[model samples]
Target: MTQQSATQGSTQAQQSTAATDAPLLDVDVRATFQEQFEALAASRGEVTALIDATDTSTFAQLEARTNQLARHFQERGAEVGDFVLISSRIGSLIMHAAIAAWKIGAVPMPVSDKLVQSELDAIVEVGSPALAVDTTDRALSVPRITDLSAADELSADPLPAVVSPQLKSPTSGGSTGRPKLIVSGAVGDPAAIAQLGRVMGVPENGVCLITAALYHNASFSDALAALTLGNTTVLMERFDPETTLVMIEKHRATWVYAVPAMMQRIWKLPDDVKFGYDLSSVETFFHVAAPCPQWLKRAWIDWLGADVIYELYGPTEGQAATALTGAEWLEHPGSVGTPKVGEVSIRDDDGNPVPVGETGEVWLRRGVGEPPSYHYLGAEAESAEDQWETVGDIGRVDEDGYLYLTDRRSDMLLVGGVNVYPAEVEAVSDMHPAVLASCCVGIPDEDLGSVPALIIETADGEVPGDFDGFLTEHLAKVKRPRHIVGTTRQLRDAAGKIRKREIKREFLEPTAQS
Candidate 1:
């Protein structure tokens, strides 16, 4: 079928199979994630529910595994409202463990599998989870499950359903110090989950592709939403530009979650290779987590039409969100779209509201009478007296009500009393063809107080000699980095986020000591 025709058909199917209207088994607000899975399993028994590199599993198989895992957690003395720390890599095992935690009325807190001992200890200290799921032999005060084999040994029979008070507890470090667990406020209610799916454009019974790491909030939430809709979810063990396209074609995925970095890699693929995949089945291509470059956004829109390309901007706290389609983006250019779920206001340092088109700290709050969406465990939230919270982001709202982000408040630099957003400088630096990645941070300057310094990862491992000239056209003198350090090492993490504070320390600490 033609691309347009396929999209139309997919949309119609999505409408007909809206999660609320579907004949799904009745589930209450107190119903566990396992109970929701069981209902889907009974109705969509033979349908493939999950796909990964190793193999595929049907809803029935997934349900059975979840039940066994739930029993294992219970046998280990896990109880309602407890937190289970999952430090394993992305796969069906971790997914099953999360559901199992929910089944026993416990929350699942996922930590990066690659975290070092020190990092792991810090998070464990903050979360104080009931149990830790890790393969490595690490002696700790808490009980540990070395592998899923322990759970596999248990019976696969169904367990009594019980929902946790919170759906999940995801970690976020922001730009400051240690990571904090942002515990979700709401429980795992099927109706609420369905409504979230509809808002996020996740089609019922559609194929959802996940390329981002499951540890990230967006990836985890989107995957769960897809599963909640009885949609087939394809999880990539790791993201490869070409492999992502291949999987989407193979699975005929209708919805997919991606971050800006992933999109850039795919867009950088060879023309012939990138165009070879049949991504016609995709109805909604959702991207979030990081700011997407204008060029990359336009390229994807050109490739997949404006209607299918979508972008979302929000924090994991769920206080507010903005969504923009490619068509709307074309008109607004860099805008991330208007506030959809909550109110957004720009405020100055004194907590006073800013006028339109002026940059300031972006604050968000839920609609009137709506309760706060999340609470932090390890760190305090930055909020005004009126309860509008700022996630340390800077942005401005246009006359048309669209929001355009500048940079993280922590990453802003003072150059001779003029503010410089690292994102602005980094965006220009990334436009250079030889630069693979760029990180801009503030460094101490005697004259200017602090000036921007750039760390660049070159594509060919050689610093471009003309880097200074490249920025002359795009940036003003104050906005351009005073120092351009080159390295073959990547500056951004897998999720396209740079630890600006960490990078700044690495650059400044040695100089200060000297």
Candidate 2:
């Protein structure tokens, strides 16, 4: 019955609408992904559809370019249901390449722009794309599109309309070294896409600024959402703390997609430097990727109005999700808020529900017998007898059903019999004036199994000799780091991940990078 309703909506949404509202309806329509751009071009040809650091493209320009590019992709063997891996520099061309893939009814999978050759091999073995786009001109396993101009001469006429089997296939934490493709199950269902757009705070005919790298699924997907919803999208070629503020004011952006790492950089800027730009133009400030530090979350709430800040927590698996506006966050400070969709519960290892407020594995159930929303390529989900599934995240719920995450089981260290999660330790240490970003990892210990260690990245590249003493006041004995170290190397990847496993291997072991 649900499938039938979606099918009906897709059929209805494809039919042309009346004038004056056609451009608006074009964005609001429910059809194949390419139809959104095609409709926008037909009715609102002159409107700016995409903007990057160097260039901007109108809807009509994008439509024609993508059409030609789509033919080029097909000439290279990309067809409906084939994968098109896009690993390119940050720019409008990246988005155009993605739109081209969608136009050809192929799944578009964006990976880290700086993917190492080793990482590329593993992903390509699993992805098996018909073609790959790398503007960096690196050697790849599949047919590669090295020059963007090569596609310009292809015919710009519309191709036969076809829907992608899946909405998109984004590599899970690709930039952070975990390269699993998360294949969404939705078949471009019009209603589902519309709801996702709204959830990301996209407003019709508004400007959406994207400050982070597009390879991150959340960042890119939201940009796609803005375009599909008939909004102007501004993509930053690279993220600069002050420039983000400048772009928002310049574009008068109504919606912005950012993660916690970007927020910290902007926050660390001197008050005068940060306050120099006009940020009153921003409306919806959406952040996700990892659990936000309490101090940082509160700081943003105080800077921007509580009503404007929003957060989401869930795995890419799509089994569960929890969202809260900053206003709601004030009521439950550490909680990620009650479920906006999908039923969430804390379960013991036996899969039985734990008492409220008891920390346990967090599980989610969309429906008892409903089909899965996503499938993984390189990883498998831990699921219970029912439809409930978990991605190894450990958390709890309050009496009011608000969720609070402790940490992921993989990242939690058994510290002398007591579990120690790094978020709390890093959160406390980040409050120091000298610290820019900090990552907490459990160092192997003979007595305690693993002992917590502090590794910080500072703006001035100076390691505070007494920083451990500063943490002494904030962290408990069990959570306190036994050793403190600092590095000039970047701590988090573009996906806003600390990558504890990688940090333990590389940072702790000096020979990794050199």
Candidate 3:
């Protein structure tokens, strides 16, 4: 057989093998999801699967409750195309409920469980989920999930056949004025899922930690992969550095998936507080919500004493575009490695492929083992033929084919008539031993049109005020920040993307009198 045909046959064999043993739940997408969850519970037995702030759910318990919720929604007025807005904090309840929603063929809109009333209102107003399932009363008037037993009054609609995993609508970042609903879909490609599992080293017996919110795509994939692999998952409702360290020690979580900011916070805990936990159980210390500073990554590697720290590069619309392990990362330094199991390329301004070594938009075409599975809700972000797509990132390929992400084109700063990429300045700022995390932006300046500004979030001993002098030592005067801001809390969104655009509006936008 030719190489192309051989590859095709190989994929077919894998799918055929999976079909024989893999009992997809109902038949359609909903049953497939139900089966995935049920299989995990059956295989894992009483393994502690998820922990919320106040409650814990074992695999069996989670499966039982999620099924009840799924039955409730199925009985309610939910339809395949209808959106199910799940608003809850990070917990087993929310994650399992989302799986149940998927099992019923209803599109699940995962709203951040931590959102205040106003944010929840905005999302609910835009998404308009047919059923609003919230666990907590973050908002006074929202419908909340009380109990599954009570759901018996609802109808028992027979589950639909397997529909493809498609997102009917998506939650926007609100980078612009208002967040709009985006049409999106999820990929059900087994090859891509298998490749992601391999890269994550998701063990059949390990417990995967979901520290990121369920609403975010990265977290969604993390939860799905954990269930698909029949492993236990521990969910963190909200990340508390001390709490996280304790949980790692307490639960003996085998794998952790977190954003760089959270890792920085965990590392910043006093050595006495940080070292008390037993992290030996964590084999896959993976992260991918945002660009991790080399310093932070190095700190984590040293702290974890595990060589399994991995980074995945992909967006909401793009899942598992590429991944790199800690060992490979040290060898390549800044590269996010080659495409995980797909094809990655850099496209220039004109939409043509840029020769290797030149910075351009990073684009991916679903490759041999990675089939195209995601679809956008609307034309705002288009996915075209050949299954190629870009997530607004600028990057380049090295001579060895490793991918180096420079910055997001949207986050680029124009300073003093010169282009200043915030990633560059943030990289320099992060080099400061005292600085834990930082974000840079161009503030309006009459003298230079726009000038670089820095917002620093200190680790334990670091101070934002001290960052300016430290930054001056590492960067040119022009690139130095005109102002420095500070925050003790998490600075990035759920996906670990710094809300720089939002930060600019809150601080720099008003006071940059120029």
Candidate 4:
């Protein structure tokens, strides 16, 4: 069957299943976050709600702890809609704090716990959160609450359930520019949470695994969805490729979230070791945050059944989303799937819609009369008329309305009047057996205006001698890198996103004045 017809069939099946299986709860989308939790706890009180490698907490236990933390936050002068900056390593404690903030009607803004004081300061300067929770010894101007132990002395009795006006304020990865807060438009509501859980295919009372950092939007959302569905969520403090496989087997995880970087690492494992664990329990293996190389995606589909592999494409801003199963992806190869929630339009510089198969800036719009799903704190969104917004992504839709991404428009290289998208080059490079990770950036060239420069992270500390031959065979001559650099250091972040602009600066800084 064609991709479009197959997708439509799948949607109809899902809707039918949902109508039959899902309970008709009187869930209020406007209900407070705390109220939602209280309802969940009452229903799934004995179920294991959250699990780390070492510790597990039931829904009842988690709700009680969150209530205690809510009182602590209140004592620290955190009021409704107050942004609480949470800077701590991923653990059960961070989840408790986030829920506690929601309980007391405070917004949680999670930043990377490993960030230096300067990086923390920049985010604080922009967000100006009312309370700061950093286990580290950094002094801050805001009221500081160090660890979960601080709430140890507080009462565990349930506090008044309250809801924040804003659900969360997650920061961007700062790949292309400065880190900015993307505050969610929707408040903490039961209906919204349930809808997200359904959309992500999170099952009730099932086991879910999250390997990415809690600071990342994808991980955070996944965790929340799992918890909302009363699933047993296994939180990994940090991603270790081998450990990830072991955890899946140990926990019998039915659903897991990963990025392409993590997948590549696992794919590199010895065949015996990689296949040693029983991964048959996994029903949905969802990957997002960055593009998955075609080869990598195919390998995964081959390893796991196509029905178990799923891909999501969307920004954290929640404006729209597209998703596809591996079976559907095989039919539509590079497409990110048709829009599941909103409309996508490809437009030229003049703001006119382009023909099918023509590349242009990809703009997304929610249903008619829908407001922007998010607003920026440190930067404004790139928006045009009638709520059409682009996150600077460039892509095209085929005749079947399946969207295929090129690269970010800001990351495009102008090479002698020909456009070169770094993602295309990097995707090709990542296919090489020796390459662990790769990044492509545009470097200044006097003759051609600019040219592509490739930076590779090899499997070992050394690059293969025939690396150029691999590139020549994979990429066109114009798209080939003019300069190649290799390092053992990783190129992508935990979420598998590359900071091409930052990498380009390192090569350009010395000759910038010349």
Candidate 5:
């Protein structure tokens, strides 16, 4: 097994390399993947690597299974640098294939199995995979790796001892007008992986539970952190609040990584329900992907203690740029944390640095010597100014250098003269016991210019009837959503990201100038 010494020199050396230069830092990433998998198999032996309602695979068993499936993919005409479409219920097979695809220099395109056929068709059309491993026996001509492969009929090839590139594919957002694919050429950087492992405090013997969708970057990256950092991962097919609680105890999971929504769902579990399970083994509860409600943040701190919940903010385009410890969160209630070691700056529209307390667009330039390398499939004109790029989030930094994001600059609502961040209002509204979920948006109002309107999902247990009087107690007059709407209407994506433009069209489009 190849092991690079976990030293400061290695980390600095890794960080110094330009982002566009090497796919993986120093070591052979493919070899690293195989070695770690083998190590996991050796150490864990028969311990489960993944668990679902109908399946469970021990670490040793999963390694063997993945090896066999890797052979199948090779036999079915899959070659190095080909995209492999992975659309299946999240399980050991999908997890195994992701590693296998990486080993063969194939990029794993993990798509949601829950997506409508049209959406799947759209992705498959554009992703253009060499092989697709789908669970259902459909009419699609792509090669499929079935459950029978777990029996292990083939010997595993010695994974490459040199790093290779898997053309960086962007996460497509269909809701924001046209679907865009952000092509990032940089392969999985092992050094960055190691740094993240340090930030996550991943132990050599740790096991992580993935409660979020595998299609999302955070879930995939967190799972990889375990493998790359020499730890086992327990994959859950789908996030179930009760099942997640049960599995945390059943697997004796050490690290828990999930989105705030998933955590809130777990928080929704009755006190008696949580008491029935033993999750004492869990050491870190990490939250990322979406902006978490402050109330949910407080509740997590209250339930599991402050040290348990750590929040990180970053985008798929830039990777995780900032990490805030729980204690740091107390010092400043809204700050995300200081900029990452490789990151720099928050700037205004005129490209000038904003004052400490003034809100502006978050702009980041890679550390010295980092090169400019980003590709977009649909949008042609690229934005590159001396290796600096902004991800369109509006935020401000405090005197101490902590960053606080207001909202997506595009989504900010200008209410008369008072600029309002939808995220802040939504965060506060989400804390209400009667509210299952809430999305705050500004709607055109003659009286207040653009007034805050909240679309809410009412909790089943708490006030299932009236929302107005219940909302009054929790919100201030100005911040209180002037208009309240039910969430039953198609107002948000499956990920719970509010479709503000869609909602705005429903309410304001007709009145627009023709």
Candidate 6:
């Protein structure tokens, strides 16, 4: 957006928001994200800071509103180091709550607004947040604040600068459906965040567009990075493949954060619609949170320039990470790239370093004297002495140091004495054009001990006639799924994460009945 267009729909309280191509946070000033928000307001105050489907906020507006809301939370008993669980539909309130939490030196824990009462209870029990926003419908264990009108009555004047010890506390629950808060070990400093962003391919002070739900790690990471860099970020309330392209074109988005599922959906769009948008503005196209099918990655690389495609792989814990450009990926086809952060290694169950090219647990230890990358609230780290930890991922590194993940140890199936990786099976299932998403889980088999059962979400909710033959050609016999089920029911969440345990349970009932 041009300077004129960005300020058009901004808050009328003060319309002097300056839109510039320059970075917002001054690394030299030594400020937390909270103080940087105010600094941005002083310099880039009138610039558009956040955008949702129905509203846009300038830096000035965000600073003032967050100030008022910070006082609101402080007055309601939230304090430094406390968790402010944020759950709301995407809009001004979401950003307002997050920035407000930061202003008061509290950690903002964003969770899915669509979570049911039981799910919310489980998460709340773990974090035990001092206060919650937009979760008004429940009789929670803590105070639940909903009305923003009262906050409007509070002073918008700046609060005393306070930096949170924990940068953020995003929730994660893979397959097990057990929610846990991942508290970042980094302080709430923009300089550290900016430094990390650069290594992760985040463009500074450019138009950023996000399609995933804000609750996800990647979504909030990009959103906050956009804010820290003074970039105008456009957020979609829900993802629509066609609308994603429209927003990119309309905003002239220079950076986009997408997961493989989202990327696949966009590519599945009619070629005319997919290729119609002016995507030349996109300098970085990012995908993570799930393993991308090689075919899909190739398609995106062919469509977008190889340099524009960026893939990052790591746990949200942040201790271990690997990244690859499309060009690098072309050279190391199935590799997730060498480590750009942390000291990553592959080790056997005995904690001995695995020989290169042999699959084992992927381990990471922080840089010398560095604090832990993250600490989990609900569970202990799967770790060893000497600051080494594993997230239960099974992978191997090539002699060249490129890492290739076979699958999660918990997700791997032992089929007739063979190590069957569900990712390999699912990747093949997703290779079929009709498949939108696929999950492979192990089912009880009298002969093989356990067999792969694939549940796929397709356009017509029916398995294609040629899918069996397609699977036969792409996957080995031991890796093949014995049962293939089709469903119209949504499989993956908005963040492109699938719940394999749920998939297995649901599919198992029908087979048992038959």
lDDT of 2 by residue, 88-157 (tens): 7656877888888887778888887787788888888888988988877557878988877878788888
Superposition error at 161 for model 5 (Å): 4.9
Ranking by lDDT: 6, 4, 1, 2, 3, 5
Q: 1 or 6: which has the higher lDDT?
A: 6
Give candidate 5 regions above 4 Å deviation: 1-30, 136-152, 156-162, 167-170, 182-185, 188-198, 372-374, 380-384, 447-449, 460-466, 469-478, 488-496, 499-514
TM-score of each: 0.90, 0.91, 0.82, 0.92, 0.83, 0.92
On residues 1-514, what C-alpha lDDT tens digit does candidate 4 reach at each position? 1111112254323211111122233323336667667776888888888888557899988888898899999999999999999877746877888889988888989888867777788888889999987777766888898866778889877667666788889997477558789998878655565666566667777999999988888888778877877788999988899999999999899999999899998998889999999999999999988888898999999999899999888888877777789999999998787777666777777766666688888877664487677899998887776676778889987776778899998889999999999899988888887888888877788999988988788856576899889989988988999888777877777667777767657654454336
- C-alpha lDDT values of all predictions: 0.78, 0.77, 0.66, 0.80, 0.64, 0.81
lDDT of 5 by residue, 1-514 (tens): 2212112354323222122222223322224455666766777767666665567777777667766676777778888777787767755556777777765666677766766666666666666778887775443545655554542667754445323365335356654655555555456445545545555445555788877666665676567667655566777776678988888888788888777777776787788996688878878888776777776777777777777778777666652267677778888887777655346456666666555577777766545466434456555522345555667788876776677778998777777777787887777666665566667777777767787877666644333454666567766667677766664553334443566776767654554322
**Which is the winner by lDDT between candidate 3 and candidate 6?**
6
lDDT of 3 by residue, 315-432 (tens): 6564335677888888888877766545665666656655557787776655434444454332355344445566778888777668888888888777777767788888788776
| Cα deviation of 385, candidate 5, in Å | 1.3
Evaluate candidate 1 by giving its C-alpha RMSD to the native, one decimal.
8.3
Please give the range of 10 consecutive residues that has the lowest summed lDDT in model 4.
Answer: 14-23
Question: Which residue pairs collide in model 5, if any?
Answer: 168-184
**Which portions of model 4 miss their true places by more than 4 Å?**
1-30, 507-514
Give the C-alpha miss distance for residue 3 in model 5, angstroms: 43
Candidate 2 residue pairs in clash (backbone atoms < 3 Å): none
lDDT for model 1, please: 0.78
Candidate 2: deviation at residue 117, Å? 1.0
Instruction: Report how far off residue 14 is in candidate 3 (Å).
Output: 31
**Per-prediction RMSD in angstroms?**
8.3, 7.6, 6.9, 5.7, 7.0, 10.7
Residue 385 of model 5 has an lDDT of 53
